[model samples]
Target: MGRSKSPVRVITAVVAMAALVLAGCTKPGPSLRPTATTNPPGVFGPGADGLGDTYYPKAGNGGYDVANYDLDLKYDPPTDTLTGTATITATATADLSRFNLDFTGLKTEKVTVNDVDAAAEQSGAELVVTPATGIATGAQFVVKVTYGGVPKAFDEPGLGEIGFLHTDDGAVAIGEPEVASSWFPVNDHPRDKATYTVKIAAPEGLAALSNGAMKDKRSAGGWTTWTWSETKPMAPYLATVVIGKYRVKESTHDGKPMVIAVDTSLSAQVDAQMAQTPEVIDFLESKFGPYPFDALGGIVIDDRRVRFALENQSRPIYSSAFFEAGEDGTWVIVHELAHQWYGDSVAVNEWKEIWLNEGFASYAEWLWFEDKGEQTAQQTFDNSYAPADAEMWRVPPGDPGKSDLFHESVYTRGAMTLHALRVTVGDDAFFKILKAWAAEKAHSNATTPEFIALAERISGKQLDQLFDDWLYGEKRPPRPRR
Candidate 1:
């Protein structure tokens, strides 16, 4: 049965490497067509309430494709409040009478469409907006929403807490599967990719960091505003903003920019682990393709509560504890960094297709260690198949149910699927497939079927049964023959 038909259950990773462990973060509007009173009617209607994502039925809205998100936010640590405006520029795919933006908790102060006042209301996580006038299809529209409130992090049933998480000094946005809405109004799904400009202003002493390269910084009235921009298309889930007292370090690796923000508390240990950032990027680029984004870096927040790290576009976010753990921490760092290509660059179209993200990143850990001569991908794959983990076989990587989005199958079994494919296609073709997949699908969303088809085309072999038995089948297939 499809995930949509099934009732939502509110219920609910380790990797071998002997070291590596598993861990597990809006909107619209327009340069809209000027509202018209006269009708040239075909089917002028409101956009779909949801994008109809199988696992996340309410994710992403329909009827429009977002082009860019300009988020101007001010975070006051004293009050723990985030005040800001989200200006979205998008093109309407259909004649839209109204549309919805995914947002939760934050208070909406004002909303505008094409610079005109529009009516807005909150329905669950959906911020439904109705323009004063109907928008025509093929017209570009602009929406600007001003909202403010104490940012709250959400405990996503099985996915852990995410959204805007308060830290010792300030707050960091972690949590995944879909938490961007908690901080800012967004389309809130992987299918909608848009360029982003995040401008954050915080108190004088506190440092605020976000994704991509830092474009500019200005200070006024004892407050500093940092501006960061990601030119490449990005999904909402990959968006991030971190504010705290951090020892911000910047360097260059092979002409690409490298920046690492280590929490002041764990600066010593984090600095050393972060020194490997350049090497990690170079290593992955050698295997996957040229680094997918213009900049490469990360942010380490000082918080033990945030046990897992997030792969946030050009810059991944980490818990300070992750760095203090030593080699295992570095391996985890590599895993998240690898996602800059796998998850951030080659995004999945639906939440159900998350194996495309986690699986690739998990396999990246194997590849990184393989390069270090510590272990082979084959050995890692073989080790993951212990009888103790047999229950993981109950659900294939392709579909692990809604609540099990972060199950071990998506990571271990998902990586195993890739290794199996490598053995079936040979090393040369396998690497070619990896590089091609990242290069071709860079900054766009993709599905499991698209990957299967791409693999078949590149290797010039039938991989249907192979993907079927490994990715979709309930029972695990016999080990691949080398």
Candidate 2:
């Protein structure tokens, strides 16, 4: 969400190549393998309350992994009330007597497991559900939660205002990090990826938009329902729902379905900007390989309340201010679209490695300018590196901490880290690393160490020192010379 806004300047500094250590960076915790010995003669126990992620430990639940989500939601903007039914299908990783769900601020009407009534209790952000019978390890189960009330849209302590946000005319659901729980019950972490079938209902005049291709829309009793299904596996943060009055356009880009929506208030100014979306996607495809998603499009919500754009699966959410900036906003479009390949397709397993998302997307912007024959990526890095502000390099991109999740260091310095890596590994191998990383990890979760391994594999060189200096060092290291 951070943007570099200074004129181009060039600087030079000394950089060095370092040793590669495969086991150096943070690694995922030991996987919990369910075994019969762990349970006492089929007497099931409760699932773990958290997934053990180092950064946000309690963001996702344990014991079960979500496979699919069927979300049916109805909202009336006049009353600002949201009624939702979330049918979650998951496979238990261990024998479970009860499980937990990440949710907040919604009234629960009823809870059912496999069509039978279940006991549901709300403790802070956790929804504890206990079914009548215990579930066996590896057994598949279904949970349906019926909830209704006015959804909360409060600011996340460190991440800013997220979740279901209200606009002048309607509401937009933007979940990143851990905010999805505010709207619907979810595993609520990037590690637990799942397919989603979102069915949304709103007033007849408003258009409902979500991730993936729109399947259909039906109207009954002054309310219209819109159905969208995302077949590919997606992290919870990338899920989104926008309900408002807008100008909708359905078209094809490079033989793929494309859907673009602009708020009626700013459609005139945003249409031209939105039209260039295809060209941006095409350019990214040429560099990053084929587009990762089945669809290619975006939604422009003209709301001043939300300040940043998000790479929400197939359709990235944009703020109307981008259009108001005219041509200056093109890079922002390119940035978010680039994330469809980096952040959405190949997600980070832990929040600490968010550089895997923001860094790649930020570097993609530099690649765009370089591809356009403008100032080379080195020039951009040089200008950014010239700044003497200690805060810029204080927190390494790999360890931005909880509150600094979206720090400017993560975006700019993160991109700089990649450029330095490109310098360490020549262009041919560096570009190969990019494409190969995306293709291999498509629709899966990854971490920084994995990316380092991939880079070493593709370049046939050790890069531990380079990554350590640029990503983990407290001070800014010398810029790599190409």
Cα lDDT tens digits for candidate 1, 242-343:
998989987877776778888888747568777788888888889998997878888878776676777888888876655554433666677888888888
Residue range 1-482, candidate 2, lDDT tens digits: 12233334111110100000000011122342212124454778887667777788887888787889999999889888999899999988778899999989998899999999999999999999999998888889999999988888877553456778877788999746776899999887777788999999999999999999889999999999999999888888788889999999999887878999999988465777778899898899888899988887889887666656788888988877655744256676877898888888887777888888887887887887787766688887877788777575898988888777777777778889999999889899999999998898888777788889999998899889899988888898976865
Model 1 is weakest, by summed lDDT over 10 consecutive residues, at 3-12
RMSD of each: 7.3, 5.5
Instruction: Single out the weakest 10-residue window by summed lDDT for candidate 2.
Output: 16-25
The TM-score that candidate 1 achieves is 0.91
The TM-scores of all predictions, comma-separated, are 0.91, 0.92
User: Which portions of model 1 miss their true places by more than 4 Å?
Assistant: 1-41, 325-327
Error of 2 at 171 (Å): 0.6
lDDT of each: 0.79, 0.79
